[model samples]
Target chain A: MRRVSLLAMVVVAAPVFAGAVADLPSGRFAPLYGLDVGQTSFPVRAFRLDVRPVSRADFAAFLSEVPRWRQGAVPPALADARYLATFAASKNPAAPVTEVSYFAARAYCSWRHGRLPTTLEWEYAAAADETRRDASQDGDFVQRILDWYGQPAREGDLDGPGSPRNVYGVEALHGLVWEWTEDFNALFVTGDNRQDGDISKRFLCGAGATGSARREDYAAFMRYAMRSSLEARSVLPRLGFRCAYDDVGRSP
Target chain B: MRQLAFALCLVSLSAAAQGEPRSVLALETRWRTESGEQVSLSARKGRWYALSFVYTSCAGTCPLTTQKLKRLDATLAKAGKPLDVVVVSLDPEHDTPEAVKAYRARHQLTSAKRWSILVGEQEQLRTLTMLLDFKYSKNPESGVIMHDNAVFLVSPSGEVKATMSSLDGPLDEFVAAVPAPTKGS
Candidate 1:
């Protein structure tokens, strides 16, 4: 019985220690907000990212493992009401989970021995267009992404994993749902950018305080704006998340 | 035997007393102090403290925040409250133990036991910040982090009582939130 229990422990512990992830090599990609006037293509460290957004089923497992994270069990400081309501109501565990706050999403990722991808990592992965690594300039790809943004988020589960893989073999970069990055709060826009006088000034300061690196990229601009508008505890109807990891031999 | 049983019952009763929830105090999480000590926030219980997020090298709102905290420290000292202050570095990659010490000395926070300047690995720092509901973002290009400027007032029991955006504003709420000095002192 002792040996059997020990074997069971390792079987359960293996996945917790070695999370499900896909490795991406070290690369460079220009982010929407970080570029200076002339600079482009900032370097990204090699990392592992989840191939798909966390599904309703995946989140249900997390709730079982960490009971404090369930919609009613969570503190108001970490997640507001309406969290995971759609997934709970639909009872369809296969759909991608939505209405998760940054705190809850982050907690879920942490429980899986992973963390949310930084915006740079998320954007860099999204820049791929099924065949090429940098597809920001691809008119058709950009248009398809922009068009998806126009559609209103509907109820019920969308597609499950492994459907829309990118060039990097990572799935569901766009046309599925908006994801929460680890640095969701870091995308700072000056008060002038928000066009709301004096509010942004109260909290933000410093250089590059002006407009985006490329003002023409309205799609990227909208992403940044959405990120900036969120507080840590605010859960949305459509926003969900996945996880990332530092490369195995690299010190985090 | 009777006294020991009564003490055990008292301990369990106190544990059940959830009147003040220290929701943010994940005492198990480890952190590095400015003076290079490794301690948990739970270790600092039994005194009221104020907590804020800052980066030592920040050129923006962080310096403004530090200045405001310095003034609040002095104000509290004069008022006989002499509250504890904790400033955790949002940019932990750059704010090393030695650097955090230098920043503390530079700010002239003399009370070592009261003024705690802390830095931790990114994950631990994130855990604390999430509990405090403080949000921050670092730009890899400019190396500047855009973050929340909220300061929190915590009770002696480790519960966060109130949060203020800027110390430059009216401090009535902050003063009220401050716990009165204990009976002896």
Candidate 2:
């Protein structure tokens, strides 16, 4: 068996009796990247995602098991210089661990017998509000998320700064830290901004043909842009990740 | 003196043959070629090759990328440089063996002797892509798959050697970098 010793620094996490997993029901919703021509809706099945981003303590526990992933021990191909930079400075175990590369994040999730959520799963879950499952159309909801996007990243000890909880009992989906989705690199934009005519046709596949369904939704567009800019090995100061499990065959 | 010289030659030849990283050679995932022939990465041993991931239905970078690889292969062949091209499907769900064959025919890439367009199970694809650090995802709503557009060079020992974002990128440099196959490797 492969062991990865993740060092969990001393920030404490609140105990969720349910092991910190929130079960989301199946539903259909319009994603930021809209449906193909003649398609009406996107169906998302039931699954469990971490209620919060993986925190310092959680990652520390991971490091204690998987030593290969520790700072300096990890290969440059797997993570860049900034991987786990946050854990090095402060011992805020409860704060969300940031500065992790997609490879490192994926390894963490796989170790737990889970995987990173798909782009659609993340988008579908993030679309919810405190009460409503789909609050994307509400102007106030959209504005608040946009405001969070514009604000500068908060520095140090980000354990639990109390972002709004969605109806599914998930926390800090936004307004805390940017996240690593399994398919982050799938959002393709050309390296150069030489857009002539029919940008979608020139660059992307089916969904790219139609562009974004909600072109007015700047917040969604911003998310897409951010996702597009990342590479698998890129480690940023504000980026972190959580894990998700398949609903089938796994007892949640 | 003759025996000692032969022994020394054998040691050097074995070292040259084992030059690739052990991790890459250990990969045993199976993939079905556009011609419906099942193969594995290890089957590509004994030959230098370049690989890229794309789907047949893609109206985006896939076509141009195919053309570029075709050109690279042609140029190498004309120069009498031996190289193989392997294109794996990112949209394996839609790019069945038949679909891959159609794609090959459409692009005139039917030379199984030179080019191989392949598809495999999702888990197999995942294993290969992860090894190469290739990222891809299917748009759930649209059924469109998007992926990183990059080519990887694999040495004759089946180890990944170099990567390029586009097919037209630094071909000469890559050609110079590729390790020649050891005899009987």
DockQ of each: 0.13, 0.10
| Model 2: lDDT of residue A62 | 70
Give model 1's TM-score versus the native structure.
0.78
lDDT of each: 0.68, 0.68
Residue pairs in candidate 1 whose N, alpha carbon or C atoms collide under 3 angstroms = A186-B137
Second chain TM-score for model 2:
0.79
Task: Kindly list the per-residue Cα lDDT of model 2 for residues A1-252, writing each as its tens digit.
Answer: 111222322323433212377887888877766466566668989888988888766776677678788887876555666677656665455677787877788878988888898777888888888998888778888778777765545655265564587998888887778788877545434322122212222232122213566755655665665665455666776678888888643565
Name model 2 segments beyond 4 Å from true.
A1-19, A188-210, A248-251, B1-47, B56-68, B94-111, B114-116, B123-137, B141-151, B154-185
The residue ranges of model 1 lying beyond 4 angstroms of the native Cα positions read A1-20, A36-38, A160-163, A191-210, A248-252, B1-23, B26-28, B59-61, B157-159, B165-173
Q: Let me know the TM-score candidate 2 reaches against the reference structure.
A: 0.74
Best candidate (score: DockQ): 1
Q: What tens digits encode model 1's per-residue C-alpha lDDT throughout A140-169?
A: 877677776665555542653422677887
Report the C-alpha displacement of residue A182, candidate 2, in angstroms.
1.1
Candidate 1 lDDT over residue span B11-107, tens digit each: 3342221222335663345788765789888887776788888898977677778887877777888888888888888887899877777777787
